[model samples]
Target: MESEVSRKVDFSIIRYAQCWEDPEILLEVLDIKEGDVCMSIASAGENTFAMLVKNPGKIIGIDLNPVQLRLVELKKAAFLALEYEEMLEFLGFSESRRRKEYYGKLKDYLLGETEKYWNENMALIEAGVINTGRFDNFFQIFRKKVLSLIHSQKRVAELLEKKNKEERYEFYNKKWNNLRWKILFRIFFSKFIVGKLGRDPRLFDYADNTSLSAVMSEKAKYAFTELDVSENPYIEYILTGKYTKNLPFAMRKENFQKIKSNLNRLELHNVSIEKYLETSEETIDKFNLSDIFEYISSEKYKELLEKIYEFSSNGAVLAYWNMMVPRSRPEELGNKIISLSETAKNLHAIDKTFFYSGFVVERIVK
Candidate 1:
């Protein structure tokens, strides 16, 4: 088992507050009505809660990590038990003795299993509001282990600051080709970065790329990106890091109220998007999959299409972001399901460099 310190938080949770998401995007992608049941992944949990603001039939949140599940529980508990001001304060607005008081009073609202996690994690809380997200402060390990090792910030700056992608790409290839670079990567991760806050150290691993334990450990390496990183800690961090500073609003702190209100109708799950499309018993009226497909290769997309068909109705809507690679067309899934909008032919669009550079697509069930 890798240490939680290295494995806990990263870039994903940080930018969770900013990227393009929800109300603006979900309605476009999911086409979900006010009372529709919604399902989603609870990466940072902002969307899960945000969708609730729409007053859906229900909101289900799923995640592979107990940590994330716990985060959801905390968010929901906060929504159910705390006042708006206290909720804001607990999540990201402030750090006060009021926090201890809130935890003490809200004990009744929390589930039995979640109690222990809360009790222990409570001691770690501090002044920053950002500490309230899914994987707070965990990136400190990432910085100490990997970012710190970049020998020269000057070269790092030139590579990242270069305006042109082609030039940047070439520079990255040259920098990584040097033997010293690879050695640092291996060494920083060798023992997993140690942490005083918890018992275990942290190691580098992409939780999204993990499979069932039946597979070999090395098999997980398949997710490593080939994109050029140019030794720029930021870009390399973006390629390998967790949170992106640029995510949708639903992922942010400002809209947590919307997420809380819509909680009942939104369901967050830990399972893969492909799994839902395959196994769902009925065709949901709307489906919004942020760009999970980008993480996978083209061959695996069939599972997605087939599964989506099972879960959709003629009027059912499909929405997703097409990451850097051209979005995979479900044309083979047949013409019945087709694009309804040209601006949305790519369904939807957010004008920003998100963790995923992609287009939002909205497809209808024929």
Candidate 2:
């Protein structure tokens, strides 16, 4: 039977055009060794492709939404068919008037359904695929409407300027964190507004009664002041419509060729994680379970962990984010799974995707 969360959230459309989590934190926590077998949630395929840069023996990307799987397939095809610059332009990272032409080159590489999907959505192709998702559109609206009310273009550019921690804090305190910014940010990001405009309300099924805006407001402040804004592609994307400076780990030029060369190691599956694990034959070495537990109940979360443990090799590591609802290795499963709390904490401190409340890493002991 489909879960309530699954049934309620629309899966027919692209929810996220790009993976929002920081692959840097993921790589640091997983510490993938060459030849490691990794399993990751395929949300827009960014992190999965990023994992390939590590030369993993194989990467299995599983997602419940076939639309998301198609997005991954399209990106993989882009890497295989286009040059680095062409791929960036084709994916909407860089300016290009020739994206449709580039897509023509990639047509042969795409699966039948994926080709048909893209062919039907040429407007998205023209606008840039990275900016086409519901979540991405939400950010676009914020940038155009909400953000302009709070700061001018010059102020936004100044916020991205390279600065030391002390200087950044001073700038934020004196110039950025004004009354208007706080009131507008909270109103835009409140649970009700976010559910309607940014994400599916069903996604918050397991979230507590805490104020979403309050938590997110503090997180935004941390990303702006404590983190290096110049080096954070996420901040760059949120403030600007595209990546103007640093790119994500997978999209960076230094790692592009490496990921392209290892494309054969990547695999995609359209199914739930529990379903995939139940039928899978491979023993996974690392798991990038990206914030999926936030939508499900605690009992369901523990049950899924138990299923994952059955297919995990001894000493295998699992990493996931807690955006709102808190979840971790259940105490009853302590004998089999050990929480790497300290490492998770250390990595979370530097996580560029600052909206998540917690990042959890665990290992299978048996």
TM-score of model number 2: 0.98
lDDT tens digits by residue: candidate 2, 128-176: 8999999889999999999999999899999999999999999999999
Estimate, for each residue in 100-210, the C-alpha lDDT of model 1 and write its tens digit.
Answer: 767665688677666777776665333323444322343445445555566465654454442455554456556633555555444433323222221122222222332
Angstrom error at residue 326, model 1:
4.2
